[model samples]
Target: MPSKSPAQAALEKADKKANSSSGWFSSSSSKYEEAGDLYQQAANLFKMEKLFREAGDAHAREAECREKCQESNEAAQAWWNAAKAYKRGHPDLAIQALSQTITHLTKAGRFRQAADREKEIGQIYLQELNDLRKACESYERAGEWYAQEDAQATANACFKDAADLHADLEEYPQAIARYEQVADGSLSSALTKYSVKEYWLRACLCALAMGDPITAKRNLSKYSSLDTTFSSTREAKFINIITDAIEAGDMETLTAAVYEYDQVMKLDNWKTNILLKIKKGIQEEPTII
Candidate 1:
């Protein structure tokens, strides 16, 4: 064989480097392995050149390649750690890590793997932590993620639970907001009608208890409109007796008011509100007529 020229040798070396770089872009099993090796080589090159950003990108690329080739758990952990490091006191970092974990695990169908992490995040913000808003956000994300996986019922339940939690915290507006969403999204018409009627009646009774006859009358009117059972002559007569007692300011009329309120509460359309208000008034020593 003829001796090779220096230019030929240099060209051969350049070709070899090109082949290694091209290997990273290959998807075949053998090529994937070669890609891994090439990624490592690129990382070393970046590190040697003191190009930290490029080095990080190279490392990330290697990790991504490994993930694409069926090393999901390793990839998730790697991205999670990187996200944590990058987050270092920055909320954006935490969000990125959490989002990446969800994305990777969901794509890989590793629901169980992501579930604990999601729950961990929720607890960190909700329970042991004092960030109710953040906790709500986490729950919302979990619900959304589950929904995307075709778990509609589970997602609905989760959102409902979060709404309840918000309610329990005396976050009435938030509770009402979430409840409205739940009501709009999944509640059956029958249930929605029942809930509206029930709550309106409760409001009416509360107004009556507070001697706010105007509000009470308005709510009662609304309740009656929604529920035919409340429009009965018997219920109307009972409501009339209370109205007359209120106008009379006659404590002597309380006995009749109590009897009428109790009867109204027993009616099918009448919710538990009338009974609650009567009970509350009886406790307050000035029975609201």
Candidate 2:
């Protein structure tokens, strides 16, 4: 074979080098496009599958492309749906969705818009469902959100409702503590009166049921002082006999009185007080007529 001229060889070498470079560039660009297409396909499939979590992951990969294509609305909608799906059986997810919604709306300067969603979640946990603890937690979250928005009364009311439910469960210490909070805070008179009265009555009933006469008497005195009509004619009559027997210092009479009262009252307190009084009297006097 005849050797080529220097210029011809050099031109040929340059052409070959250009072609190789072009080929490499084309291959790299094709691979990048393929990756982009795969990501889009995965996102579409995730949407169809209602797999929000996977969709979110896939969307994160193409976030720049999504922003350029005005696909943020679609991403937002997907996140919202996924949050809802988790909410039915997952309280934590519901809370996350609510938080995200608040964040997004607040960034957009539409705080009130986010508030509606938050209130919906609060009502679901508080009223429609009977999960009082969860409901109260939700209310507290709402109250914080409302307070941030300067809605004081709404926040206070939420706290009040939470406290009332705690009281209903007979958590006396917690109930009393919450009641004190309301009394000290800017709570309304109507609510204050209702809660105080209800808590007092419940405490009294609980002390009575627990067979604590001292506590019962204290509660009774408070109740009677508050409402003069708070009278149990039957109980008073039954107790009168034991009081008389104690004052008379007669064991036989006390025993007979308690037995008679038991026949009429048939309650532990009446029997207990009668026996206690009779034992005390008998101990004080060794001789009985």
Question: How large is the C-alpha RMSD of every model relative to the true structure?
Answer: 14.8, 17.8
Global lDDT scores for all candidate models: 0.55, 0.50
Runs in model 2 lying further than 4 Å from the true structure: 1-96, 105-119, 127-129, 168-170, 186-289
Query: Runs in model 1 with CA error above 4 Å?
Result: 1-74, 77-99, 103-120, 168-171, 184-186, 189-289
lDDT of 2 by residue, 27-51 (tens): 5434333333444456556656666
lDDT of 1 by residue, 79-175 (tens): 5554443333334445555666677887888775566456556755654456777777677767676667666556655665566455444454555
**TM-score on alpha carbons, each prediction:** 0.37, 0.37
Q: So what's the TM-score on candidate 2? A: 0.37
